[model samples]
Target chain A: MQPTDLTPHAEPELIVFRDVSVHFPVFNASTRSFRKRVIQVATGGIVAPDHTGHIVVQALTNLNFGIRSGERVALFGHNGAGKTTLLGALSRIYAPTSGSAEISGAVGSLINISLGTDPESTGRENIFLRAAILGLGRDFIQKNLEEIIEFSELGDFIDLPVRTYSSGMQLRLAFAVSTMLRPEILVMDEWLSVGDKNFQSKAAARLDAMLRDTKILVLATHSRDLALRHCNRALWLEHGRIKLDGPVKDVAAAYFGK
Target chain B: MLENLKAAMADIARSRHYASLIHILGWQDMRHRYRRSFLGPFWLVASTAALVATICLILGPMFGLPPEQYVPYVAAGMIVWGLIVSMCTDSCQAFISQSTMIRQTAAPLFTYVARVAWRNTLLFAHNLVIFPVALWISGAHSNMNALLAVPGFLLVLANLAWIGLVLAILSARYRDLPKTIDSVIPVLMFMTPIMWKPEMMPLRIGVKILQFNPFYWMIDLVRVPMMGGIPPGKVWVGAAVVALVGWVVALILFARTRERIVYWL
Candidate 1:
């Protein structure tokens, strides 16, 4: 793909993945010992080398993609079609097995928003932990603590352990803390659908403001309407390959078969 | 190579940002361990006290050693061993416990190991309150040289850091490592000089075997300071070597295979 098509603006390319592939090796549970299994593989034993066991499953195959500064791109794909893997590659959560993925700007991922939050920690404490996991410095979180608490709308619950909060409350707290700090490259994997109707609109406006300041926004979602509303460009991934890549409207139509 | 070490040190120095995160996690872990219980962290002290009492009662008489002498000895050994074993067991689960974080976030992988180490250190600190009590009860001799235990404690912390790094990375890649450590720690406990004094062992066979066991060296290092004695220079040198080698090997492994750890998980 050309640089213009991939990274449209004059802003520098923040993330680039050339011929990236992610493969997971399946292992047999019944194998008596690791050495014996290796020996069996070395010998001419008729051990079934299925993808389910003792074989490799290619999750992403020779994928080529790039995200430029100040651009919001939506990665649309079915389940197990490498959408999350591609987003993970940009965040450096999952390194590409064979190809190079170079990301210049700082990246913040909203995938698994509560991944770093401790169940026994207060919501206020979890904010700091989650912020650090998102690469925000401690001083920054300390400075923005009040704003995060206000945005989360968890007044009294802020001091309670996140485990005490309901799922919606937990999501609000996590999202509020995550968005408190601006990142050069912001990544989201279906974490935006956390708030209620009114809160969703508020969150959407906040996200729009963030997108304006964010150098690059990579979101992986199943929602075509949301992608069209927020993302300037769209990528359609099918079977671990980018089937189509272009303007949001055209890609959404193709993806939805409109 | 020196530049890399400098860079690593710089990274570690700036790690306070990461430490704040670990502080939260460590606090959460400690809280979670005793959330349903009323006693909380005191449970660790109580358990250590009970074990010391039992071992002192049984092993002291069986070995023809006085309770006054063996009580402090076993107490010191058990408390230090508790710290070591806790480090070992917790390090094995370090990466596995934070698999979600590794899979989802772009933060440094070492943060999880630090969380485990910090949590165990907190527990060890709580358990250490018993040391003075045991000393008072047994009337063990106190000396200026015994203050060297502070450095000994730091050495134990450093050893835990190395072990945490190695085990976290290994267990992340190999799912069986937790189980392996579970079985290995019991065997290691027996091999270490926790229950029996090293002098009790016959010189030719048992003493030679204990000499080769690194855990024995570590136990002697910790136990010596509490007993108002100096650890041998050889033990100090050997500990330094083990810490250096363990850190170096762990660093190499982490640099080479850190990227794959998330995928493996």
Candidate 2:
């Protein structure tokens, strides 16, 4: 099927979450008995209660939005405002409790770039491991092994475990591996700010390259300028709901009230 | 559903080396465990050796078994049991242990489980060297048929995969699983035929009860090759069937629960 036909009504929206509401049960700590838990739930007690007086932290509440193909959408929100949660839903990290999230194409998320890197394993080995985790076949990693190593610029350190490398070195290696293959849907959550200034420009360039082929890009960041510069559309998530959705500049201005 | 299973099988076949990814991560775990210790990985071998010696000295005479035979038996059992125990316990905490990674990455959760299993498997391999050395030093008969233990070893690996899959998902969703496993494994060890032969049970009821323990079959399967005897067909069939069933159930649970693991954690 042609890509355009995937989401016929929406021009092949890459990611769509329809009226999603994720409610986790909160339970009382003192009553550890099953009967008590049952009673608590029956009486509107939280199934799993957090430390806050509120039984459950409504992480994301009735979130609804769609990103059309080839659109770079920025998710802007304060801490705990569900920007990360929404990004996670898109990445299939967190399935919505009450709604369905449909994606038209393959998604690659840089939520944690170095998810499987071993401190004791050489960079080359970690590249294989990380690539496999990202759903890349072993042969694919093998073919691009040299390219991945060169892009990270670890040179001789490619043989050393990542523990010895500086954090910048680690991020560069991770970023290089993650972006080596273009993904139809790319989700990033504040990973662009790798520590090194030199690597920052390199990372930005790599990200730009990825963006070029990327059909859908959903980036969640608090930086207004970053959102405006990189994204054409912006979504302001407040209290787990979409507070604003429009042009990047308009949403950023409304989100920051500037 | 069959197609999904076929796809998953193909996925596993394509990603078989993903199992080795655990070995690499296990190396890190071993390093982390011995980071500042002067002895490092050697300490694992040393400690296991000491435990085996102590157990042999105390229980060999108590059970009326020769130290020569008993020491190697206990040593091998300890290595295998340690591997299984650590795999179960560690996998329960798999998602929790990598909370930072779980929150930040979109990688499959199974990678963490594989890492734990592989780490324990390597340690099991390291501890395995002690058995041959102990047997040689103790003057026990080292039979060539010990090579037959390869099948038994493969069975244990299969069993471990099933256990890892189930516990990894369960422990991710339930915070209390690791603690529960920690408390129960020693109890399970006592219940199993690790240190003592199943025939040693004085009561018929006790023998029947021990027979019911799946671990008894596993230990007997492996011990047969090492002890230079053919394990009963029942033992092999029973162990294989249990492993297969357990594996299927675990995979189903893993596939169903995996999506919720992140939320639970």
Candidate 3:
């Protein structure tokens, strides 16, 4: 992957993964139990030759990719095709068990927008809680508090405990707080279609503005239309390996059947 | 091995940058527990005060020590003991409770441990209020020596911080460790001289066991100072050694398991 495809950006690459692989060692009830482990030690039993005896799931294997500045990439795959795992690795949640993934920018993940929102805390309080969880400093949250509240259209309801709010209202509050993140690299599991139709348009507009500022976007989704519309590049992952990587229209056509 | 250790140390150092984040999360945890109650966190203060009063009223006479002598001792012990027990038990769930956040966000692992440590510190402060009340009730005068508790309490916190981190990481992987910890802590309470004075025990077995019980030294580090006595030089040495060694062990364990913790969850 060359850095010549996109705009004349100063940075060569925003995200790079060279032969990155993530293997989860699945510790089931038997393996995770302390007593059983102790018995295995005491009796010198079930000492399988090596780590091969353990159950390990290869979520991602030998993924080689680079996302440059001013590029919007979509990860397409089947349900267990490692799309989410790739995004997780990009957002720094899962450390690659082998090879390397170097991400040099602040990663804003919309994977779970209401990640730190508490049911008992007030809407305003949840705003601070969620933003802090996103690693935003207090001054940033404080300065943009009003604009966020205004965008969510929460108005007087911002002071109420989130539990008292309807599900849509709650989503609005969470959506507002999530959009406040000004990360250099933005990650989304799926396009966050939040709230009712009227609110959706407003959210789309806000997301568009945010995307304009974001230097890189890595989205994992099943929506072909959304991918073709918003993304310039697409990676088709099959069974934890990249099946194809190219421009969105060509990859989408190939993966989704011509 | 060395690289993992460096990463673990880096996580510890970087968690300091999230102090405000941890502070708010910890405060939110405390508030969530007592939000509906009228007394709020004072409920902790009230319950601790009642426990101290009960021990002074009943166990004081049962142990054959006058309230003037016993009240302050038991109060200090109870207060410090509460900190230790809760820090231990709560830390077992530190990562477990925040599994959702840990799997979703890349915040430092030590940030969650610090949250547990900070919340327990807040509870310990509430419990500290009982010491002065006990002193007033017993008419026991604490001299300038009581100021030693400031440093002593910091030492105790430092030690508990590593212990909490180790438990958090281990229990996150080994699901049964928390249950084992829960059962072991009550037994430890009886073994340690919390409710009764060390003088009540038979010297040969009791003193030797107490010498080895790290909890005894940990409690004495704060309990003795709170009651206006300087802990023996040996006690300081023991607590400091435990703190240093415990952190080394915790760092290594955390480094080895840090990346896999998300998988375990």
Tens-digit lDDT track of model 3 for A1-258: 566644525557888899999998877688889888788889876677355256889999999988888889999999999988888899888999998999998998888887887889889988888888887888988999989899888889899989899988888888888888888999999998888889999999989989999999999999999999899999999999999999999999998988
Find the 10 residues in a row with the least total lDDT in model 2 chain B. Answer: B7-16
Separate clash counts for every candidate: 1, 12, 0
Q: What does the lDDT read for residue B186 in candidate 2?
A: 95
For residue A214, what is the lDDT in candidate 3? 96
Q: lDDT (0-100) at residue A251 of candidate 3?
A: 96
Model 3 chain B: weakest 10-residue lDDT segment is B197-206
Interface RMSD for each predicted structure:
2.5, 3.8, 1.1
Please write out the lDDT profile of model 1 over residues B153-203, one tens digit for every residue: 788778789888888877766667678888888888878888988787776
Better of 1 and 2 by TM-score: 1
> DockQ ranking from best to worst?
3, 1, 2
In candidate 3, the residue pairs with backbone N, CA or C atoms under 3 Å apart (3 or more residues apart, or in different chains) clash, namely none
DockQ of each: 0.50, 0.35, 0.74
TM-score on B-chain, cand. 3: 0.97
Docking quality of model 3: it rates as medium
lDDT for each residue of candidate 2 in B1-265, tens digit (9 for 90 to 100): 5554554454345445455455556677988798879988778889888988888888989998987878878987877777777877887788788877776665566677777877887787787888888788778876777887889888877888778878877666555567788999999998887788767878989998777887667766777788677788888888889899997887666555655667666
Q: Write the per-residue lDDT of candidate 1 for residues A29-50, one digit (tens) a residue.
A: 6442344555777985866656
User: lDDT-based ranking, best first?
Assistant: 3, 1, 2
**What fraction of the true interface contacts does model 2 reproduce?**
0.35
